[model samples]
Target: MVPEPSSEAPAKSFTDIQTRNGSIYTHPGLLSLPPSSGTSSSSGKRHRFSIIVPESVTDQIILKCKAIASGTSVTHVFIAALAMALSELQPPKEESYAVRYVNHSMINLRPYCRAPYNTREHAAAPYHTVSAQALGIDLVVPGPPIDGKDDGQINELSQVATQVRDYFRTVRPTSSQDEQIAVSPLMFKSLTTPPGSDPHIVSDPPFCPAVISSLGNIGSIVSASHGPFELTNVWAASEPIGAGVAIFLGTWNGRIELSGVFDTRYHDSGYIRKFLERMLDSVSGGLDVDNCTAPIRVTPNEEK
Candidate 1:
């Protein structure tokens, strides 16, 4: 959670994320996750911002964290990092919030969907399930000098990672895989349906605000070129369904990437840029906590 919102002012932070170039800490309203299926009636422009992480960093974190404990994957650490970033940054309000619980949703149904339904050909949709009620508060955000070996930053991050890992591990489906194929037409359309509609489906833990799918080593699937059209790069994003935002993660070429999509109508771009910088800072710091002894400034090699 946050230390406290200052009496002076705040840097745009969030109950939600900022715009591609916009800030999420503007209006004083619901920064709900698994945003309401219906598009926001309040209009605003949308913007996208993205950054790539070095492959070296990804590999190191994976190797080190994997050795820390069972189920301590790099994905777990990244979730901790995301929670840390969200807590530290201020949402756009007259006064920022003192974070208590992080309202986040994580959804990936591809593995659960069967056959043609799983592929994009049949419109493999993403869902947003939100609960105004906050979830558990076991996550801990690491503080300064994260690179210092004596501060226990790594241990703290590791604990947070473990908590996240355990949560998913414990909640992983106990039922057979076939039971998960409940994505009926009503359930699927309900994601984008307005509240007035009747779709009596209830999603446990609700859909997450974030939908991250690892696009492992992109070079594996993509061909070098298609006829005369050469393929140099690929960028992807799962935009916010309602007034909120969504982030995507993957590895391409030699770098890991993060892309955030938000509407400029609700967020301010300048502030969002600052927010993104802080997030990258947290990610780099957390990843390097176990490697380098001295602190270092990691720069973005590419952008989206």
Candidate 2:
């Protein structure tokens, strides 16, 4: 299940995680349950991912996401829409998304899960292992995104919320002595297709479909005015698995954006772009939301 920030204690404060580097000692119990070292039979893979924000900041590019292709909440919306679209275009290995995380054994012996976006401080290791099921049917959009969408329309927020809930239902931590440990430095990729020595097929698939994290959403960071550093949004993602692509999201234009990064070995970014564009166009045009839907649009650019 996606880890929620503790309301009881203040969040860890940091000057600059990128610059400062040191390994802090965490409890031993934290590492008791070893994380799935990208080695599993079923290979969980998360398909869609997103974050919800306000429409006001939809166009503002802060530190992370730049430009407003869509509006606030659009990121989260896009993820849901994109996920649904992908489901139709390329059905995932499993219906549930495989959301990854930086397991911090020190924070609570379990793993300190990163927030969805950039936060106040950039301390502590930002890499660990944890996952949540990205499935379900009810999104509680905080702002405008919730105003006009169809009453029963299951947006990304709703879907992700459901996925989070389901994650808790399935797994439960045995202890709380876990602390900060095993920080994911820059990036992590999933083995989408099962690894093999074959000829025409992918060697590795993602252990999970989606990897959701809260690396950038530090409340203090979000509120502070760091000179020219405008805290626009945050995002997290990993490499692709099998023939499928990788997904990432952060605060873009004040809302969440669904971004994809795939391994060129399986397919080219152009193919993924074409597929996503067509998919977005299909769902956006079909969205019957009266007022809540953000200005959903797809771009025709490749990451390379």
Candidate 3:
């Protein structure tokens, strides 16, 4: 039987880790730029699209990543794949001005909430009345094409995946309740501050090139029946917040869905579609994985 989820607060060691890495918000290079000065009215809003990864393919990806990177998980592989896709789609031209892709992933704090506040049962509770919280952490990775010939595709992805895994392992918060609460005020302050004043008031700039949020396994959540209710599909979407792109990953009924939110000012619908297709192709062995040595082609998907 599955054990009940823990409601304990994070430990002291965990809080220490969070405090040390809090600089993510203030990193100068990670700061975002305001929407272009000559922006058109249409450029003000965000757009969204989605792609589904069948369970079979997801399983294959998991097996492949682990075989190549030892203990790396699917999320690490996916993030590495995303970094690769972004690099392919927008290769930086200048040697000195390459883009350093940064991904901010949401970390759920539900498990650390005290007592009754620990479970999703209190999701409807008012923000001020509940102890639930969530935090975002930056995962920085190299982007832009290398100058030399490409190495074996599988080996390359594995190397990237290992780097991703090591980065997360080093920076992830240590489990501690007090530390989680201590950081809440900072997150709140950052959220309440005006965008125009964020740079001046907040020491850390809130700039992320890309964001990834996983909702974990939702099969059980939907499986809970209510008066003969039956569920079919499950997915989630969100507005593009401060980032050029955001991708939400969720699993239900054994399938994983990737919902990508993009700022139309930066990328169009066609580009988003092609980006998703390329991402799928990269993981599903469409790209030559055994011995290919050239950068993966990133052709746009043709409109019907």
Find the candidate with the highest lDDT and give its number: 3
* Runs of candidate 1 exceeding 4 Å displacement: 1-43, 90-98, 101-155, 171-192, 195-217, 289-304
User: Which is better, 2 or 3, measured by lDDT?
Assistant: 3
lDDT of 1 by residue, 77-194 (tens): 6666666655554233333343333433343454444455556566644433321112233322234443453234322566677777776664343332211122222223334768
Against the unseen true structure, what C-alpha lDDT does each candidate score? Answer: 0.47, 0.35, 0.52
Question: TM-scores for all candidates?
Answer: 0.57, 0.38, 0.63
TM-score of 3: 0.63
Off by over 4 Å in 2: 1-83, 90-122, 132-164, 168-225, 228-237, 277-287, 290-304
> After superposing candidate 3, which stretches have Cα over 4 Å from the reference?
1-46, 92-98, 125-155, 171-174, 177-181, 195-208, 285-304
Write candidate 3's Cα lDDT for 2-22 as tens digits: 122244333443455446545
Q: What is the lDDT ranking, best to worst? A: 3, 1, 2
- Per-residue alpha-carbon lDDT of model 2 for 1-304, expressed as tens digits? 2244354231221213322322221221111111133334343333332324244433332311212222223333444454444334332231233222212111222243445322325455343443211123222222223355533433343344234434344333443312222222111222133467442344344222322233333443355447787654444555444544555444444453545654444344445555545434533443432222244444323332
TM-score of 2: 0.38
